[model samples]
Target: MEKHSNVKSRRKHISPVFHLQTKKEEDQHITKEVIKSVRRTGQLNLSSRHIATVPEKLFSIYDAEDENTVDWDFGKPKKEEDAWWNINPLSHLDLSSNVLSEIPAQIGMFQDLLVLNVIFGIII
Candidate 1:
């Protein structure tokens, strides 16, 4: 009985450790470069980014200004195929291996999304 009590007391002092991030830290995982790639490829792999919440920009990346819009060369004529409107729409989103608690309602905006891999993550 004394041994059981001592074991229980020892376990009480041992608390599980968790890695918490600030709002800025969590948002840092999603950058302009990442958005650009996703827009071009139509696939976003945000796995293992430790993000608790999905960034709003991820949902509306098609409307967001990108390098092509801002850094256009006026000296040369632009190609029609390279236009921002020609970019591929986001279709595949991989949010696996993350710490997401709940998927945002904005995710529904991804009408073109074909694959949303949320495996190995906590969504509750």
Candidate 2:
């Protein structure tokens, strides 16, 4: 009987640990490609990702270039389409069905944001 109780207790503890590890891995899987796509399309859908907090990288997607890299093409004129001003600003964000507890104040930085979907979620 003591061994049975011990086994149950261990199983319960292991279950939460495993769940936490899986959540951590899923959170880390939010890759640079996703961010780049969002930057280009001005839309981000992170629904049902089990994310408790918004990733910090999303906040700086517009200025992701390294400051140390110097553009040596001073002689060449910049193209209109390739200009930084041409990039699409973040206008839509879908964070529904996530485990988010509070919307970060940084979200307000997206001045061009037109659609923010937080349905089926709770925000404090």
Question: Best candidate, lDDT-wise?
Answer: 1
Q: 49-89 in candidate 1: lDDT tens per residue?
A: 77777765575567746556575475543765446666888
Between which residue pairs do clashes occur in model 2?
Answer: none
> What is each predicted model's overall lDDT from 0 to 1?
0.78, 0.73
Give the per-residue lDDT digits (tens) of candidate 2, residues 1-124.
9999999889876644223224446456456777667666888888877666776667777774678977778653365544565678899988897667778899999999999888887566
Candidate number achieving the greatest TM-score relative to the actual structure: 1
Model 1 scores what on Cα lDDT? Answer: 0.78
The CA lDDT at 44 in model 1 is: 88
Identify the runs in model 1 with alpha carbons over 4 angstroms from their true place.
1-18, 66-82
